[model samples]
Target chain A: MIARLLMSLTAVLIVASVLWRDPAAPVAQPHPRFVKLDKHGNPLSPWQGPWSCVLDTTQQLVWEVKTDSENIHDGYWTYSWYLSGDPRTSDRARGEANLGDCYFETSRCDTQDLINRTRQAALCGLTQWRLPSAQELSSLVQAPARPGHAHIAQDFFPHMKHGDYWSADHSQPLSGHYRRFKQGALAVNFHTGKQYSLPYRNAAFVLLVADLPSEHHSSRTSGVTHQPTTGN
Target chain B: MRKATFVFLHMLTIVLVICSLFTGLRFSLLTQDWLKFLSALLPQGNLYFWHIGSASLLSALAAGYLLLSLWRPYRSSPSHYHLWVNRFGYLIILGLLSSGWLLWLGRFVAIAQPLHFYSLWLLLIYLLMHGWAYFIQHGKYVLSALLPKQPDKHSIAAVISVTAGGLLLYSAAQHSAETLTVASLAPEEFIEIDGLGDESHWQRAPVYTIETHGGINFDDGRSTIQVQALANSQESYFLVRWTDSSMSTNHLPLLKTQAGWKIQQNGFYEFDERTFYEDKLAVMLSHSCEVGADNTAQLGNRPLDGKPPNWHGKGFHASMDGKIRDLWHWKAVRTNDMYLADDNFFGPPAIAQQGQRRYTAGYQPDGKESGAYVMNWQWYKPGLVTPKRLPDQSNAHLSVLPWFGSTPYTAENDDFAPGSTLSSILYRSNRFEGDRADVRARGTWDNGVWTLELVRKHYTGSEHDVPLTNGTCMWFSAFDHAQVGHTRHMRPAILRYPL
Candidate 1:
């Protein structure tokens, strides 16, 4: 009986040890600035690399850009959230596709389907979101060697995949010219047909940006006060 | 104890044989030339026989050892023989895998050779076997551990084995650095010549030496020549000596011509005459070659009419003039009546000329002319003339409008009429005035195809008629073979408008 009791105690101790081994230790929490997500959502692995949310002032839109070496092209690409529900429904902010704007056309956005998607996002109070320009996307790349810029948020957008991301910038149609930012190397994509894209309703990732004030010329004698604002 | 000793020795022998086989093969591959020389000393077919014999012996030993290890009935006992074999085998496999992969991937991928693929397969198999053995022994707990864990006795052994295996593998891969012989040529090195009969050993003495440093270091020296050649032999001989400084003069040579001070050189000539402190010296030479009756170098019926022919043996005379301070500053002027060989004909062969009252400037192929004459000396520097000046500092007027093709005009007077058209204007300032003077002009082409004219206004309050000097003006024209005549003669007069 003593042996049985000791065995039982040992078994219980083993189970307790396994279960108590820090649940929160390896699983890091997302930064507070990031948008809240459902419980089932899992953040990117921490081992990946740096990630940022870039916000375009002209379009008032935000995008989640990730940078890592594991990507096929050794660059960064945008990732959009994939939510569940009617893609056009006001409450359906999920299931958005992560499409790259390698070859942009006004006709694609003006189609009935995209129009419906935009209307739904607007009705859902997502009026401030739109595609980012090529320049806006390139600004998010943080130079690892030089760290005067913003620090990479550690927890939420880790394991950022390195690949080509879509920018609203377009060249002549059929001529494959697109912008791609890979670890801060902004290059134009010559192959339009291979561009990737994501839907808007998805909860991928995004970067936010605000323009700083411009310097005033000393020659101007007028004592007019200047206010800084986000430039397009 | 005897059985155990035999087992250990057997395993050791197997490992040594395998290692030696790979090592020998790799050594033969790497030292191909050495091996070839050695083989020559042996009987013709004996080299192949010897290779087969050694390989067979090594394989038999390894097979025998393996068989002995497996023959043991008691599997539970930790045989020292088995342990040693496993340890050594693990190292050999790891080393071979890594070194082979690196070499094959780096060198053989571009060639797309069959041997590269075969070697790659062999390496992959070794890696897989090693991985399988590792997982089977460690179980899940240890398997989950990250690579390159802390070095203990097992890991230390692994490290050592891997290092040894790497060296052996590298040797077997047949990779070796190339050997090259290097020698330097200095300024003092003399080149000797032999067997030329009478002028047999004419010495070449380098005069001035120009050494290019930094990017690509090379020394090139020039020397004055004294020739001595055999009458029969086509080859000529000359003696050369090195001098310290350049011998070029920075002044145009005054030629005594029948046309009274007219600049004339037989074929082509170039000269630089400038008073600037650091003015470059100029040199010029000219030559002329005959072309076929077709007005072209008929080597292949190539265009010879004012165009450089694209063939061999057609001689071209080139005269270079410039300051001899540096080898890079030397400029050459080439002229050849042999058709396309000297086809760049927009103006006279002379680059720049100076006269007492009037100077005839040479024109570039791009229709821009530059020359200076005694125009009432105001400030010495010539002022520029353009159609319009932009506030943003953008030089939009610099672009040559096609309508003003080689027309003569002046800008001093508001002369828009045909005879009184301003071809060009000279800028001048009175001695009493502190301000400088400028000139400008404007006009249009007659045909719908060409229009837009301009002129300059001088501060001297003097008006010069357009096209008065030699019926030529500084204008812009395109280089089209078909439109050469029409383009050259269409120079319009410059009209001056009020500023």
Candidate 2:
């Protein structure tokens, strides 16, 4: 019985060793700063910060809490604005929501209520605002110093951690990570525990807008052209 | 036996992988776009990590296999397995060396015109050899026969297989790591002139223009120009003007003329100038000027100009701006003594004769010659008391006199003979005197041609003589005894005359 057990144990050990030896395992290493691709490769989306969503029209989509000017941990303050259109379909709501938790930071607060309020605010606008698509978010992943960033031209959350951003576009199985400097796109596995999020309703910072005239109907949610809000 | 086969196959595969990785990495470095894409796929950090990981894994596996094979008790000794593995390892190494040499030759030498095909063939051959070896070793019952033992053979095979697999993985990792580092830092572009002519006569043109189909903006400083001539099938001469400003101008010389025309700082200009003889040759000169304040100008002299004139024409007035305007003309005349002859040797009293009956020689008053008899004489004849000596007697001891009088030979009329009457006169004398007089006159009745000979002996013992007919004449100096005496010597002897 002892010999049989020893033999079985040896066999098991051999089998286990073979199985554990993963030839294709990626060695633990720092991620590349710029993810280049061939002509056929797709672009990555912006990062998703610490935020959750709930459909509510009564409250603002993203509210900031006033904190110490130097430190974000001091306290909270509320800044409000009226939504001109439905939060679900308005360009303003889409643009604001696609920024992820860096600007929204809804993960720590009432995520569901915040999402609902965002949708309501977008719907309240004279024109509709909705979440930006993957392509739209990708377009914003330009070099940090490019000229087209008029309103939100500056990175809204300067202190936000740098990594891959989540996009509404789920074309690829792996989530996209947009690089900061080169604006390169990378496909990352969300399950690999490499994701980070931003907080919501933080007002110690400022929120920019693209103020368009009332005559134009800005309800179209095509990922092609969505200007940032001009007003505060 | 099974253990040996596994080890052999694993080693062969590892060698092939390494070679392929090396070649691929080199290609990637030469082309930047490919390198960039590769880097993204396998970042530097990951490449290094994987390299270390794979090497360790493969080494561990190989060691484990060896150990297990050694520990097992087999009917056939482990020596047989060891021998097979050794043979297989040797073959792999040989194959790798051969493939590497072929690749290196293709890259560095012109052993073959189309190296790509040769390299590909070599790679294929290596693969085939590897596959052939694998098949032979893995054939059915080969391992069993070699092992000849039950439990020992199985355990030994297991260990060898594991070890080989680990080593293979390790080799791949190392290759990948090397490739990642080298290719990431590859150059972006290789700049070369596609149609530049031969390097020897390459001319630097002033302006180089590049036209790209796409709207690409090149930094002004980084650009260069290449110019070629279609007519001569040669590179044109030019100078590069690197500057900070945008505008520049220059003046270039025209062909065949000493004077060049004023050309704008940056455009093509043409001009023509007349030669001294009023002959005209077209001068085609071109200048390319870049528009910049810091730009400079260079003048290219045509290849024919040996020592180019210093921007000034002699005997011509030039303006303050270096322009040649007016020219001055000068004339010169020369004179020297010469013996004259006529068609007939017996024309006047000034004639003299001295030679034998068949061929008499003398001097005549006219310059034309008529008969076959010839007479030669030297001018500036030496006096009886003093024999003339040549100043420069290095080669021939013959005295030479300037046919025309002394005058500076100018560039304008250098083509014509100095003593020709058409352009200038050299010498003329009226008095005729000599040692004594001797005459031989002959007249041909049929052709009305008369031939005569006359000789004049001077007081100084020197004599002048000539043979002449009605239309023929000859002249000579009797003092030239070095020659065949005055009888065979004469000056300006006429050789031919018409009836």
TM-score of each: 0.16, 0.20
Return the lDDT, model 1, position B312. 16
Regions more than 4 Å wrong, model 2: A1-220, A223-232, B1-45, B56-125, B132-499
For B1-499, candidate 1 gives per-residue lDDT tens digits of 1333344433444444344443333223221223322221122111222222333333343344355456642243444744655565545534443333332232332232223334434544543454344444554443343233334553344334444544454344322211111112233432222111122122221211111110100011111111121111111112111121322111121222232122211211111111211111111101111111001101111112332221111111211121110000111111100000111221222221100011112212211011111111111111222211111123112221112232222233222332211111121111111011111111111221111111111122211111112111121111111101101101111111111
Model 1 residue B486 CA deviation (Å) reads: 76
Clashes of 1: 80
**Local accuracy by lDDT, each model:** 0.25, 0.24
Model 2, A135-188: lDDT tens per residue?
A: 333333433321111211122222211233333322222223322222211211
Reference interface contacts recovered per candidate:
0.00, 0.00
List each model's interface RMSD: 35.8, 50.7
User: Global CA lDDT of candidate 1, please?
Assistant: 0.25
lDDT of 2 by residue, B191-223 (tens): 122112223323321222221110011121111
lDDT (tens digit, per residue) of candidate 1 on A1-232: 4554565578668766664542111112222233211111122222221223322223333343332322211122233322234457654433334342211222222112232343344422233334445565554443321111122322333333223444443331232232232111122221121234433321222332222112211211122122111000
Q: Considering every candidate listed, which one attains the maximal DockQ?
A: 1
